[model samples]
Target: LLQGGDLSCVIRERQNSNKLFSEVQVLEWFIQLLLGVRYLHKRLVLHRDLKASNIFLKDGTLKIVVIVPGDFGVSRILLGALDFASTFTGTPHYMSPEVFTCSGYNSKSDIWSLGCVLYEICALDLAFDARSWVKLLMKIVHGPSPSLPESFSEELNHILHRMLNKDPMVRPSAAEILKLPYVAENVKVRSLFILTSL
Candidate 1:
């Protein structure tokens, strides 16, 4: 299992990165975003907390999102390729309600949250910031998903729409999403890039 250097080295270099949104290829960016998560699920792990901030690049040049162990202080537990989770946990704004209130959850919920993160990354705001977590969760469960802005790329908007599916079972798997056209494009793409998670 010989490769390059360690990931920490990459992390160190990434510290010098301006920001993920600046001068990054959309394909690589999308891959890193989803690959980071896919790597975890493949290891029979769930990120529990998948967000824009937590998902970071290593070398800032490889453009590959490598999943280490865990973040948010979550130690990655390699449980094999199983998809059952208990003792639910995750961030409120981006979490599947089941992660907090209910018992049944799995890697797919993380995918849903990833979808939310992608939506936020593209639109530059939290898609579900009603007033509080409770309000937001209710809205997510009862209200319609946030509509993609006309200003945003259609491909990205399509990907985001599929990710925000309320039913976890219906949400596209990260692997499936990585194959989308919006993700494969090698163009200079940019949106509002605003930060409101508000």
Candidate 2:
């Protein structure tokens, strides 16, 4: 959704779940992702790298093709990665700690990042902005994240909290998140609440 040109960091941050981006706008984008994940999980395709900046919005009101194919980060040609579950990869703001510890990771790791994405958009701030490899790794391993804003809907807060849980195996998959009531029936309404608050 950003206009083309080499992006300026300031402009990038402003677009990153900033208060001006409207929660509904964020939610709408998320809903599309959820649907995409649903189809992807069904195909046994896991995106591994998902973040606010990577997710794109075209019509601002489109859906049905939710997954935004062709950009699953480093997995584009591998069909999946070797040692896919353990390679420490992905962006810091949304990457799971396991992705860095060299512990190897998987689709579940992507779900965790998805949680960060949800949290970032609602807060209109990146979860963790690290400056170096060590710092980024340290943050993912032990940093406190951007907390759920006090004004958020209870359902949105709940969904985000659930996603952020540290155990990769325990984290819900996109398919699973989609089935949750918050994602299923009320993204529009709860998301609308976020938009109005801003």
Best by lDDT: 2
Q: What is candidate 2's lDDT per residue for 1-198, written digit by digit as tens?
A: 443322123236666545455555656767767776666666656566676555654444322222334544454222543436555555666778777666767677767877877776666666677778789778767876556777767777777766776667778878778778766775667557779999
Candidate 2: give its CA RMSD in angstroms.
Answer: 6.1
> What CA root-mean-square deviation does each model show from the true structure?
9.6, 6.1
| Cα lDDT tens digits for candidate 1, 1-198 | 013443333333444552333223434456666766777677676667676556544444223233445334542464555546676556677777566557577777888777776666544566788777677778767677786556556666676777777677777877777666656443223222223332
Backbone clashes under 3 angstroms, per model:
0, 7
Q: Which candidate leads in TM-score?
A: 2
TM-score, model 2 to reference:
0.72
Model 2 pairs whose backbones collide: 17-124, 85-104, 85-105, 86-104, 86-105, 87-104, 88-99
| Residue pairs in candidate 1 whose N, alpha carbon or C atoms collide under 3 angstroms | none
- Model 2, global lDDT: 0.64
